[model samples]
Target: MQKDKRTSLTDGMFLSLMKSSLKGISQVILIENAVTGFIILMAITIFSYPLGIITLSSSIIGTLIGKLGGANENNVNSGLYGYNSVLTGIALTLFLTGPSQWFIALVGAALAAVFSAAMMHFMRNTGIPILTFPFIILTWFMLLASYKLKAFQLSPGLVPQDLSHWTLNISGKVDWLEGSFNGIGQIFFLDSTLAGILLFIGVFWAGWKYGLFSILGNAFALLISFVLGGEHSLIILGLYGYNAILTSIAVSIVFKEDHNRFAPISGIIAACVTVPLTASVATWLLPYGLPALTMPFVLSTWLFLGARKVLPRL
Candidate 1:
């Protein structure tokens, strides 16, 4: 009896740890691979302590609430239930300062979990992946609402940094490879070159194919943005590139199979469209002082995927 009780307790703890790790990595839209999760957790922690604390706290809270709300056990265990919540945590922490409204972050996380579950149910039959829509919607609402409330003001003194310090390529231009690596790191709201390098390594460790598509996305976005004459500094800082990176990867790996001739083509299209779409969305949201968080990726992925049904031949 004693041995059985000890084993049961051990199993429970192990399961809990696995769930937490999955929730952590789900921030990058990857499933519950603990190795990937550990890398992402380390990346965020190294970037900022407050970001780390809120990410972990909101993730755990979201998971518990998801389980209570009867979200699919597999989804909860795999951390799908917590990904949007993690995004919520990161989004709020990235924009808002101080611990005073940490409670708001927790509340937003809980709502994100609920919205995630609802989206999963609604889209279950539509064959549409509800990737991070909850985060996009909730964060947008929070940002717009905050304009009227003093508690949610933008992080004071957080101006965009000048890009004078980045190492330039031979032509004194933004290095595509460097921007590609930074694009991966930018997913977690990191901007440092080392963070990007670590994430590039992490994705390769997760799956070589994922790494490949990520690089493809980044490069395609960089090329297109340059051709389109996007702001030089923002392009180099990778501000205009991260969405395309994620969209390319998602359209290729997450939504379509490699066997589909259109997979690579769709990825390229997603990358190309990301810059313009993000710029358009940013303009629309500028009045609200709300950043267009992941709108470009979400919209681009949807366009590419939805187009497949009518045009099946690409």
Candidate 2:
């Protein structure tokens, strides 16, 4: 009897260790993915390149990783949708200044991973509904960095310039049309035309494969924002949509058994809603003398709390 009990205890200890190891693996994967995404974003920004190839490449990488990790088909499919990378890309665009800024990007990525893991833990324990922790953390970090550490500038025009001159290869009539299309598209579509289309495709595909109703929930939220004439432009909306896709993919992989049930849905929603929420909050908070060093931590905490409440419901 004593031997049997010892065996049982050993087995339990092994299981616990394994679980902790798996959690650490997931966190490492998230950080690596974020760093890779930052590198890709920097390449595009500095080299004046289109993001299509990089985006697709990253999706492929994510899908392969999911598959190799014994993720289900749905998880692989969601990873291919490209939402996490989109979040990383957006963060890189906003926060990256030069090669030296890679350290800061790493800091942001580490915090993002912590936020994501804590969110998952909270949702598991508390039965909360969360869908956008990544964006919430990322935006808050950028905002605080901008104000306190001078990590970034508040130039919303940066995206426009990058899209127009560096990436799109537009010139002459093509340039004019592209510029006009982007502007008009932002007013109506919710991002640059290409990004909007990609986001729509990614989200629609995930919804079709998994939860149609949950997808509708996300769509309804966006529609309400649109109808209310929310300040989010098409470009910004596209970014949100892209982030949603990545979040869905990540959740699907991490919570393999529950991929189709609530994980993807919750993750997508959290990612989609976080942008506007953070931006609004940041606007109010920045003027009050928040330090840059604390921004990432604060945002991570809020996201962790919100996710705890939001993820389980989905």
Number of the top-ranking candidate, with lDDT as the measure: 1
Candidate 1 — worst ten consecutive residues by lDDT sum? 161-170
For candidate 1, report its TM-score: 0.88
Best by TM-score: 1
Tens-digit lDDT string for candidate 1 (1-314): 99999999999976785566455565454545667776777777887877878877778778888677776777777777778888887887777765546877888888998998888889888767888799999987876566588777667533333344434332346667666666676777777787787777777777888888878888888888788777666676787778987887788877785568778777878878999997788666654567777889989988888887676643
Candidate 2 Cα errors over 4 Å, as ranges? 1-86, 95-99, 150-190, 207-314
Q: Model 1 scores what on Cα lDDT?
A: 0.75
Regions of model 1 farther than 4 Å from truth: 2-7, 10-14, 157-178, 257-259
For all candidates in order, the CA lDDT equals: 0.75, 0.38
In angstroms, give how far residue 63 of model 1 lies from its true place. 2.0
